[model samples]
Target: MKKIFVYGSLMSGLDTDGNMNGAKLVHADCRTLHKYAMYIYEDYPFIFEGRSNYQIKGELYEVPADVLKHLDAYEGDFYFRKLAEIECGEETVSAFVYFGRGHFFGMKEVKGGDYRAFRGKDGN
Candidate 1:
């Protein structure tokens, strides 16, 4: 099983149109870890390495290897997946994280690093 971390549209329970549907996702749970920063890129959130202190919150889902291809296609050229370690409860698990490739200069950073909470406050 391949474990992947989704913080933006693909985050489970988010009412976004880009969410992965019909994908057999399992062992899903919310988790937070360090070493990245999330920003409002266009209409959604984009995360990339370059910041510290802020812990990124997202859902970790276990899926089949083939699911990665679908996710890649769903993510499109704007994102590329990479392996990253995240804090799940008391343990750290290495999972695939999507890093945005599009330009995000001058965009507002999601200070809390929690997309859901950011959406609730800013309506994105």
Candidate 2:
């Protein structure tokens, strides 16, 4: 099973069509080991490693090889897929996380580290 961590629109209920169509959700409270900052750009969310105490709220999904390829194609140049160890409840598992590789300037930071909450904001 190919495990992946999704922090933004890829999470369940966020994407209407469902990015993880054939995948199974493994954990609902997956978080990154390292700190990172998240911002909303063009109504979408991006997370980059930097000076922030935010743990990056997301979910862990176990997908098939075919599903992984589809996700890679969907992300494209928007992000760089990297291996990361995420904390899932009492266990720490290695999963693939997409780090934003594009230039983001003056983007609004999602203070709570949760994309869903950010989307619920007034101007979001």
Report lDDT per candidate: 0.73, 0.83
lDDT of 1 by residue, 8-122 (tens): 7677666552445545554444555666777886677888777674678877877676677888887888788888888877788888888878655777888878887887733
Name the top TM-score candidate. Answer: 2
Provide the clashing-pair count of each candidate structure. Answer: 0, 0
Residue 94 accuracy (lDDT) in model 1 = 89
RMSD of 1: 3.2
Q: Give the Å shift of residue 59 in candidate 1.
A: 0.5
lDDT of 2 at 82: 87
**lDDT winner:** 2
TM-score (all chains, Cα) for each model: 0.81, 0.88
